[model samples]
Target chain A: DQQVKQNSPSLSVQEGRISILNCDYTNSMFDYFLWYKKYPAEGPTFLISISSIKDKNEDGRFTVFLNKSAKHLSLHIVPSQPGDSAVYFCAACLYNTDKLIFGTGTRLQVFP
Target chain B: GAGVSQSPSNKVTEKGKDVELRCDPISGHTALYWYRQRLGQGLEFLIYFQGNSAPDKSGLPSDRFSAERTGESVSTLTIQRTQQEDSAVYLCASSPPGIGNQPQHFGDGTRLSIL
Candidate 1:
C-alpha cells in the first residue's frame, strides 16, 4: 500500500513562474513531511520540510504548506528557475519510526 | 566535509549470482539508512542502523538479503542469488542524532542490474 501519493506524474512550467507540487498521505500518524529533489543518476536531495505543529514553513524561494485535516501538503516555488528541473518526491515519517515513506515522485521541467 | 559516498556506481551480474554494494556515511553521523528504487517506482525502505544499536531489517524482502555495518562508518548490503526482480538503484543515506526530524544526506546510489 502506498502511504504517500503524488498524483501528478509530470509537471511543466516556464521560468520565472510559480510552480506548485502537491502530495497526499493516508496515514494520520505521520507527524513530519519532507520534500526531496532528484537529478538523473543522483540521490534525492533535501528540499523543504514541515512539522505537524506548524501549518506552513518557508525557506528562501521555497515554501511548504501542511493541511492536517485534509492529509495534504504542497511545495511552492516562486519564480521557478531552469535549475529547478528535477523529480520531486514527497515523504513522511511517523513519530516513533525511523523509516520514511516516499511518494512515486513528480518530474518537474522548468523551461527557460 | 563530504556527503555520503557509495562505491561501484553500476554493477551488472547474471542471475543466481551474489553482489555486494557498499556505502560510506558522513563522518560522525550515527544514523544510516538503505532504500531501493525500482524503475518507475517510489523509494522503498530496506534497513536502518543507529549507532551501536541493533539494525532494523524489517524492510528486507527475503532471507537472501542481508546487510552489515562496521563501526558506524561503512555499510555493506549483500544480495545472494540475485534475480531479475532485484534489479534497481540502491540508495544509502545518513542523518544526525535526531530521528524523524533531521534531514538525511544521500549518496549517489549503486545501480545493480541482474541479467
Candidate 2:
C-alpha cells in the first residue's frame, strides 16, 4: 500500500514566484514529517521537517505546513530560484520507529 | 561533514549472477536502512538495522535479498542468483538512534541492472 503520496508528478514555476508542493498520507500513526530535495544521480538532501505537535516550521526561504487532522502536509518555497530545480520528496516517520514512508516524489522546475 | 556513501555507482550483471552492494553510513550514526526504487516506482524498504538489536528483515522482497550490518557501521546487501526483476536503484540511508523523528541522510545509490 502507498501510505504516502505526492499526486503531482511535475511542477513548473517562474523564478521569484512561490512554489508549493503537496503531500498526503493515509497512516494516522505517523507523527513526524520531512521534505527532501534531490538532483540527478545524487541522493536526497534533508530540507525541513515538522512534528505532529507543530503545525508549521520555517527555515529561511522554505516552510513546511502540516495539517494533522487531515493527514496532509505541504512545502512552500518563496522566491523560487533556478537552483531549486530538482525532485522533491515528502517522507513521514512512524510514530515510534525510525522507518520512513516516502512519497513518489514531485519534480519541481524553477525557470528564469 | 561527510554524508552516507555507497559503492559501485553502476553495476550491470547477467541473470543468475550474484551481486553485493555496500553502504558506509556517516560516522556515529546508529540507524541504517536499505531501500530500492524500480523504474517508475516509489522507494520500497528492504531492511533496517538499529544499534545491537536484531535487524528488521520484514521488507525483504524474497529470500534472495539479505543484509548485514557490522555493529552500527558499514552494511552489505547481497542478492543471490539475481534475476532481471531485481534491477533497480538501491538507496541507503542513516539516521540517529532512538529518536524516530530525525531525518535520514541518503547516499548516492548504486544503480543495478540485470540482463
Candidate 3:
C-alpha cells in the first residue's frame, strides 16, 4: 500500500516561473512532512519540511504548504531555474516512527 | 567526505550470489538508515540504527537481507543469494542524535544489479 502518492509523474516549466509539485497521503498520523530533491545517480537531498501543526513553511525559494484536512501537501519553487530540474520526493513521518514514507516522486524540468 | 558516503557505487552480480554494500555515515552522527529505490519506484525503507540501541529491521523484505553497524560508524548491508528482483539503488543516510524530526543526510548510493 502506498502511504504517500505524487500523482504527477513529470512536470515542465519555464525558468523564473513558479513550479508546483503536489503530494497526497493516506495516513493521518503523520506529523511531519518533508521534500527532497534528487539528481541522476545521487541520493535525495533535504529541501524543505513542514510540521503538521502549521499550514505552511518557507525557506528562501522553496515553500511547503500542508492541508491536514485534505491529507495533502505541496512544494512550490518560485523563480525556478535550470538548476531546479530534478526529481522531487514527498515524504511523511510519524513522530514515533522516524522512518520516512516516500512517494513515487515527480520529475521537474525547468527549461530556460 | 563531509557527507554520508557509500562504497562500490555500482555492483553487478549473477543471480544466487551474495553481495555486500557498505556505508560510512557522517562524523559523530548517531543515527544511520538504509533505504532502496527500485526501478521507477519510491524509496523503500530497509533498516535503521541508533547509537548502541537495537537496530530496526522491520522494513527488511526477507531473512536473506541483514545489516550490521560497527559502533556508530560504518555499516554493511548483506544480501544473501540475491534474486533478480533485488536490482536497485541502495541508499544510506545519517542524522544527528535526538528527536526523529530532523531531516537525514544521504549518500550517493550503491546501485546493485543482479544479472
Top candidate when judged by DockQ against the true structure: 3
Q: Give residue A16's error in model 3 in angstroms.
A: 1.0
lDDT at B95 for candidate 3? 92
Put down candidate 2 lDDT per residue, B1-115, tens digits, no spaces. 5999999899999999999999999998898999998876678889999899998898999999999999989999999999999999999999976534667899999999999
Error of 3 at B62 (Å): 0.6
User: How do all models score by TM-score?
Assistant: 0.98, 0.97, 0.98
* Predicted model with the maximum lDDT: 3
For model 1, residues B1-115, the per-residue Cα lDDT tens digits are 4989998899999999999999999998899999999999999999999899999999999999999999788999999999999999999999988635888889999999999
Backbone clashes for every candidate come to: 0, 0, 0
Report how closely model 1 matches the true complex, as a DockQ value: 0.89
How do these models rank on DockQ, best leading? Answer: 3, 1, 2
Scored by lDDT, model 2 comes in at 0.93
lDDT of 1 at B109: 97
Cα lDDT of model 2 by residue, A35-83, tens digit? 9998889988999999999999999999999998899999999989999
Please list all clashing residue pairs in model 1, or write none if there are none: none
